[model samples]
Target: MGWFSKDIQTMDDLFVHQLQDIYYAEQQILKALPGMIDKATDPQLKQAFEDHRKQTETHITRLQAVFRMHGAAVKGQDCPAIDGIIEEAEEVAGEVEDKRVLDAALIAAAQAVEHYEMTRYGTLVAWARQLGRPDCAAELEKTLKEEQAADEKLTDIAVSAVNRKAA
Candidate 1:
């Protein structure tokens, strides 16, 4: 179903729709990370993308488990938000001429994606609790923590080196 076309007659429906949305977003991130890893000039930044790619694999598994818990099929809807974020990242990365500047741009792009994920996972956790599925909430909480950590790590990398190098 299209974004607005989902029949969200109840909170449960909304919750499931959001779950699918994030699921799709994660898949897109998985596809994008390899390219980011390839484009990264700094060794640390490259490693971070690689590590997060692995973490994303675990996230997909967790999402699948959540689907099972919700009695929903393991699938995803189109997530244009993630697509646009990733596309912007690619475009900016291509435009950057200096390696250091490209690294900085990459960090910024990654943080944008992480911020989006943080919001989605945060909402999912709250909705799962409201839906009386503490189990699902607990699972989503794990992913939320990971996203927060990833964002913080990106910030640390940016402040410590990438941004200064770009300057």
Candidate 2:
């Protein structure tokens, strides 16, 4: 359903919709990470993608648990935002011939994905708390912290080597 669909009349409904949105986004990220890992020229960047892929699995599992806790159906709706981000990443990676520069692009793409996740998780945590689901909030907060750490790691990789080597 659309973000402002009439189906979401209550705060709880809004919370579930957000959950499904992020659920779909995380699945898409899982699918896209292998390509990122293979395309990354830097060992650190490749390993980072590999590590996050494993973490994404855990994130999906946690989301499913939250769904059960909230009594929402364990299913995901379409999330075009993530699709577009992955598509854009693929397009840029295809256009860049230099592997080092491609690594930089990949890091940028990964960070975009991480930032998208961070915003969704951050919102979900707050909404969960407001809806009297502190349990759900606590679960989502774990993923939020992980996403934040992933973004910081990307920035560190970028500044410490990837961006400079690309230049």
Candidate 3:
């Protein structure tokens, strides 16, 4: 369903719909990470992608748990943000023939996704906690930490090699 569907009239309904949107985005990302891993030439970048691929799986699991806690059914609505990110990554990665350049672009794009996830989870956590759903907050916190760490790892890799190599 669309973001503004009549079914999601209340703030609570909107929040649940947003939750499903991110949940679906996480699942789409889980599918895309392997391609990023394969495209990356730097070992650090490769390993980071591999690690995040695993973490994204756990993130999906945690999101599902949060849904259950919220008493919302497990369902996913289309998320244009993630779709655009992935599409942009594919276009850039395809155009950059140089392996190093591809790796750099991949890292930048992946970090964009991490940043998006961090913001979403942070808001979700605050809302969950404010709504007196500590369980949901805790679950979101787990994914948020992982997202932050992933962003850090990407930064470290970019500074250490990916960015330098691309230049």
All models: lDDT?
0.95, 0.95, 0.89
Model 3 lDDT per residue over 1-167, tens place:
55387987776776787799899999999999989988888999999999999999999988888899899999898999999999998999999999989998998899989988998899888878777888888889988998999999999999988898899
Candidate 2 deviant stretches above 4 angstroms: 1-3
Descending-lDDT candidate ranking:
1, 2, 3
Q: Cα deviation in Å at residue 49, candidate 1?
A: 0.6
Where model 1 places Cα greater than 4 Å from the true spot, the runs are: 1-3
The TM-score values for the models, in the order shown, are 0.97, 0.98, 0.95
Q: List the residue pairs that clash in candidate 2.
A: none
State the lDDT of candidate 2 residue by residue for 1-120, as single tens digits: 554768889999999999999999999999999989988989999888999999999999999999999999999979889999999999999999999999999999999999999999
lDDT score, residue 98, model 1? 94
Model 2 is weakest, by summed lDDT over 10 consecutive residues, at 1-10
Backbone clashes, candidate 3 = 0
Cα lDDT of model 1 by residue, 1-167, tens digit: 45465587889888888999999999999999999999999888999999999999999999999999999988898998999999999999999999999999999999999999999999999999999999999999999999999999999999999999999
Predicted structure 1: lDDT: 0.95
